[model samples]
Target: MGTIVKQNKQLYKAISENKRFSLAIFICFMAILKIQYSNVESTEYLGIADTKEININSSHSVKIRNIHVIPGQTVEEDELLMELERPDLDLRIYELESQLNELKAENSFNSEMNKELKSVKVSNNENMDSPLQIKINSMTKQLIILKRKKADLFVFSKRAGVIGSINVKVGEDASPFTPLITMHDSAPSMIKGFIHESIYNKTYKGQKVVVTSISDPNKIMDAVVASVGNRIVEYPVRLRKSEASVTYGREVVIFVSKDNPFLIGEKVQIKSFEKPNEIMTAHAQAVPVRKIEDVIDLEIGVDIENTKVEPSGLVYIKDLNQTVMISDDTGRKDRPYIYTVNNSGLIDKEIEIEGVKAISDMEAISMDENGIIYIASSMSEKKNGKVSDKRKKLLMIERNDFNFKAIGEVNFYDALNKVAKSNKSEEWAQVLLAKGNKKIRINIEGILVKENTMYFGLRSGSKLTKDQFVLLKINDIKSVFAKNAIDADQISIQANVAFPIDSDFKNEGVSDIALINGELYVLTVNNTGKEGGRVLKTVLADPSNHMTELKRFKGLKPEGITYDTSASKFLISFDQGDKKSKLLLVDKF
Candidate 1:
């Protein structure tokens, strides 16, 4: 009986040992298995790295109608590269030239007549200074201008190089604002590679890069990183098993020796790649803050000329077929500033309206469907970002034939202050070292009337947190007015829109706002002067969504943007400061 019991105990111990050994083997196998290993480290990209090149760009939108040279063709200095077709511009040039020739012929005749008069000793000095002489001088000036315009119709190469690449073909609309062709010199070839994202942070300009021929790993060359791209793009050639996400990388150009044997756009391997010591990235650089003024100049562009003062507001009245521009100057008897400009680029007339109180500084103007012109003055002192101790100004006008007469007036200070006080402005959110000394004042820079609602644009807001904008609904505007005066605080206001501080462009909130083709376009300028501003657009259906980039402005301080259906482009006005204010018409992107 004892021996049988001992045998049972031995069987139990052997079974326990076998179970523990099996569990240990299973655990060891599981430890060696890879569940979520990343292939980002092993990825490589194929890119063009050969030839010294130059990208020829167009500064304006134009249609390419002629290609003078093909790729691989050699070109000389001042050689014709491409011809842009601008039918309207060409027509204008022809007209100007024709008018100039006619003037020159008349001037010649007048000169002969004057010589004949001198020979006859005609004593009348008045005859010598007749309108013909004046006209002759004007025509000579016009001829010189017409000749310059005629010469600008063609594009020419500044430096001689081979046509490496052509981005445009025959009879296509091409915007010369971007690179249209590449001209490359016969210099030593270089290598360009798209670094894997996992190792992208380790790359930088002036860093060492190892290049090895993919076909033969033994052939290798040491190079330096020449440039790092700011944009992410797809690999030109896809590897056999590269995933879609890993296929995208920042283009990196490397410097190669003159005798390098790598073909232009060849595949190569980079060795000894290590993660970067530190990675630096930013949405945008912070710029300097500007001083605030009582009257912010909302420079609205118009097709008008010979105005006495700077234009602050603009409105296009369809019924009268006229565009109205108002001055940023104080309404005084001496400075008559309200003007009506015809679409033909002529200042048709000026309107004189008597003010009940004061129209010192009008910053924005818009026309309603009922032919009523709405005018608004800036409420915040931009330097201090403070609301004015006085009332904000608002005015409405109705044009009778060519006469623009005032229809109503309002004090908007209370309403603007109320909206500003509700939120804390994030002025320092973008600046590196600026003191937040003043409260963010809701400065209404622009106004739009849509579906019985008024959307006021706040030009000041901290980025990443709250961007500034407001929507107000006014019921029975005419009924709300009493004796040509109204209180904007009494209107029914909707929730205001404030952008968060996390946007790529954390510049000053917005300079102006415009509704174009069902999208709201907001213009922002760098207050800290760290980076150029951006024109952002958002769909009306979802204004809460982050606005996407539409246009970018650098050096050119754009004050306002408006869409012209007649031209199908955006007209941007720049602050000339004290110089002649200018307007630029850019293609909408």
Candidate 2:
């Protein structure tokens, strides 16, 4: 009986041991399964703190006639903050109305005549004249005039919002096409932020975002990604604030949802995830506090799945161990280089420059010899060619040898006609003539001649000799033949005469000719102490015939003229009394 009892106890013990073993195996398998699932789901997401901004003003430009509201003033919707006056446009409209009235009167008369002919059953030449037609024409003319007048009185609401700026005053003549006032729209606010083009692919719409207003510290606004633009430059991001939220970029709109109101044009803090809620694994130091570009001298580990963060620095990653941070040892000007530890636990490799940033730390995109990395500096340098002094000034005439001399005394009328003909082609000549003659004896005679011609010369010579006849018509005379003379048949000619025109004179004496937009422009100023200035334009073919005075601005005793080819305009700087210089831009003609 004892042996049987002992055998039963042993069987029970064996059964209990088997059950405990099975439980232990099951728990071990579950633990392995949990670790595998965690590994598959685990990920690290790089996040950046973005500022939410609002653009209060609709247009990029504005002309202020008056600033009705101050910077801190709170404004309501559709409020009249300022007024704009367009005087020139008003006059133009009145002229158009008058012409419309005449056309309408003529049309009314024709309609009445046609109606009368239709009413009359009998068609006859004697009944052609209809009194009704005359009355109908007059009424039609009046209606046409009224319609034309209505078209001229045009006005635009600068913009629909609170007034931000008013630059002009009442009774002041505002230049056309200039802005008068700026308006800020309170509704539909957006946030503006700049991101690199490399990381743009990772960002998408419908991503959840937490926005905290800068002006109202306690308010947290919930929003989502709106629309993204196709342009790659530093772009503006707009966040459609929830209802009752204040505008972000402007100063007039305010929100009362939180304890404090959100100021217009104020920046707000924002946090968003690039992907759906995933197990994020990131070091406390890896996440940038301000912006990714602002970080420097920090090591980072990133996942291998996220290609955007591949090779890392403002990129997306999938696994942590695949990425390793290294020290940046490359010089600033040289290629950006990074030192990485090898399998032997020694720093063995260096990387070249990969990219760069303005707001962020410099990124090494490539490398060079000696395992050095090159990073792009923040400044952008450009090279340009130097301008030669010879090209700045225009050349009028080449050096040449020419002479002029008169054979005998010429009459006042004849001399004057010769001078005018010589200046026909924009060229002037030096006139030379004999002034007086000296008698050596009955057989020999000597003569003295004056050769240079002044800009303004009198026909009558105040200084001349009695016996020496002044000849003004001589075009050329040989030096050998006129060395010394006297034969009754050979007339004594004047000597060589030359006058050099100074083309280098800039102020008060320089004149310029320009061809702009297929029109000839002649700029001339009277440096003779006359306050006269003229700007003329004409066809190149017939400059003298159809010369039109485009601009007759009178101010400076004019001196020099220059035309800027790039601007397609001319500038005339005048010396107004006391060395004060005035520059006028001639745009038309």
Candidate 3:
């Protein structure tokens, strides 16, 4: 009986020990699995370092007529790269043109016949919408549409880039689905990457990341996260650890210096530095806070020019205690003169620019410390898409006593061509000369002369991207503009710097620029007919720093800005459409 009881106790003890040991092993297994999962959710992510691709295609079936550019050729924005034509489209256009001509002849004959009849009035024939007139109008519309279609066959580069590939031959038949040409941005400033969801919360915009080349780890660079996607996206096959495994994460874009030493389409590994809270705090603090105040309209007028003042540039004249304002020669009929307005908003004097055959497009005005005045034209194509010689002059004026006399005029076209060629930026001059669209047209909207250096601010955004604006500098202004005939070689191109554009005001371009106490302020106008603008602040020395919007105005088209040192405020000029332009004093800018 004693031996049986002892055996049962031993069996119970042994079973309890086995259960405890199995529980411990299971716990250890789960801990090991957790560690492996954490390792898979790594800080490193596969990234593609490449320039943005711009694919050029045709909307309809067409045959290539000519190819002007070869593969790996550098092209300027709006440069004619290829020519294409469709036989079917040409035939349709020809038929429409014939129909239009026949209708016009018939309409003219009918009008003459109606004049001979007593019941039909000659005025009625002109105003009445008869069946023949309706037919003519419809035919005209059709003809215009067909002609526009034919014009699209001529392919122009939409941006400045290098020709990546030409997919079709010169005489190959291609459809809308076929990409005729591929262009890659000349600068690889961005990297595309993805992050796993498990560590998404730790990553943020503006965070510093170290990028390493997969094949050569020694080639590494530091970059900043420009943006992060809002939603999760499936990882690309190249980024996945296993080809068959599916995974998702958020998209991220990293910005690097334009001169980074990396080849396009190279595979890289990006490791994020864990600093989410710190980065968010820094970005939030960078934005400046200000209130939008009411624009105090100063009823200013220049009566010598009966037309609307339509002021485009303004500069403060302390010697005369007045402001000198200039109007753009957009109408091409107005007399060119700079009018000095007193503090009371009345024209005190009119100074005419001598030795010029006609009024030029005076877009900006600046005054040096020695009282030398400089007036800059738009230096771009006319509003009618025609090239004008009168719009390419930069006049230098000297104020003697109370009169401003024109000293000399610089041929901007010749000077810019020389500067661009020397700097290997012939594309800049090409874009300025291109006349089809206004968005890419290079216009000088702001001029600033400080310490003998001249800074010309561009009104158009960057040709490659809208997220940047350009400022071209000319060192030693006196050496460039001769007393009589200026030579192109005398003009010194110091630098062509691109500043970060303010993204808050979408589709807005620089209308004017002013410098006060070494800080740069720019006024941008909406190009979408919204009749509004924003005042932004930036530093010229640091082009990488983004601009901050100081103030935004609605229902006003701000065209000019000048800082009043004595008053300690900014004076802005506006275009009032039918009414004369007025000046506004912004107390806090």
Candidate 4:
């Protein structure tokens, strides 16, 4: 029995120790939770403190005149602040009125003696002497003098307030534009302050503000934003009476409530209450995928006669918030898929994907409802070959039977050397060859090369060519060929006519040909073989007599000419230096 009792005591003690340990752990956990809760509560409220002072004086200057109110005297609204003096202006008005009175007396005497004049004579006499016929000239002159004198004694009150300073003595001479005294209004006034442009958008007019007076720490005023400055001014408050040297802040005026009586020139702490900026939210499907070069060509599924097909990698969106899920895994092999929202508002996930069509090397493809895809212009990196291949396959093609071929290549230096060997003037030959080599490719189709003469066709089927043909040496011949030619489209000229030379041909011959304004214009290049080639126009009516040089255009190279019938303009390609090209539009010819 003794041994059993001892065992029971040890078991009881072990159970009691375990219970105490558990209670201690629970208390520690509760304490930690309480600390966390306190931290979260602190974040809910935020406060700031600023230094402020009262401003008794302002920087604005005012003119004072009427001495009816003495210093420290209370005044009402519209009460006189001061009057501006204008002695010089009054004397000038009196002198002018005296000269007018003498002229009127002389005119009156002439009118009384002109009673027997004829109609023409009377009209002539009135034009010559009509100024001296006034009777009240003396009284009118006196009245004008008195009005001028009255203006000199006028009184003005520096905007409604109490007179603070009296700089002008009663007998002191005051200038018209000089300040006489200082006036200030101390009635429950507002604390005018400014905020910077960086924080201007965060604040709005009529927002509630708390103004804490600096002179009286316990004095707090409730105010609202009264006005916002239309213009942004540089810091260093020139208008305020403070001497602080900080620059770069904004000015704001806060109207104090009648309940808060703050003294003028008293600096106050202003805490403005501003609403948080609003953020926009949109469905993930509304985001578009665009290419860096072209955003218009995003793959979009279109309905063609009840069948859906992708076209030009471009999609037109009829509505937003609705999306079609296209399967895309960013080239990952892990079951490439997409989630699409259908017309029924059901989200479909894990849909099989073909490929992500891209607009260019830099943009990705995104889709919306109706299976329409858009181009995402801003992408982190260029798309891989998978996206490029898909986009190429989706581009639309027009069914036309036009064939193009590259005939031959001309080395610029070799061509220039050959021209120099045949022509005695190497300088002129070099200049002409240099200008021609700067061009990418010169295509002369529908050109007839017979014996030593060549005829250029302005159109595909035009029988007539330009009347004049430039004489060329064997070296001037750069590979000749015929393209888009038919047996009936050959050029056969019967007679030779005299070529008319216009003023434009004095510098250089026509380098390129294009049809404009129902006439043919020959593009001329400047003597220098610069990157930007000049252009000139030639009218081709009779082809023999109507060859006149028109105007020259700088920074334009005529290459690959095509007439746009829809726009009625000529699309000329300008070789923009580095393998790149620009299209120049000429609507007027």
Clashes (backbone N, CA, C under 3 Å), per candidate, total: 23, 52, 0, 33
In order of appearance, the predictions have TM-scores of: 0.39, 0.27, 0.45, 0.29
Give one digit per residue, the lDDT tens place, for model 3 in 162-255. 9999999888899876889998867665788898888777667645567888888777876666668999999989888899999899998876
Q: Estimate the Cα RMSD of every predicted model relative to the unseen true structure.
A: 21.1, 33.2, 23.5, 31.3
Tell me the tens digit of each residue's lDDT in model 2 across 24-54. 9999999997874543321112112222222
Minimal lDDT window, size 10, model 1: 278-287
Error of 4 at 394 (Å): 68
Instruction: Identify the leading candidate in terms of lDDT.
Output: 3
Candidates 2 and 3 compared by TM-score, better number: 3
- Mark the regions of model 3 whose C-alpha exceeds 4 Å error after superposition: 1-302, 329-334, 418-441, 461-464, 483-504
**Better candidate by lDDT, 1 or 4:** 1
Worst 10 residues of 4 by lDDT: 303-312
| Error of model 3, residue 34, in angstroms | 89
Ranking by lDDT: 3, 1, 4, 2
Q: How accurate is candidate 4 locally (lDDT)?
A: 0.37
TM-score of 1: 0.39
By TM-score rank, best first, the candidates go 3, 1, 4, 2
lDDT of all predictions, in order shown? 0.57, 0.33, 0.70, 0.37
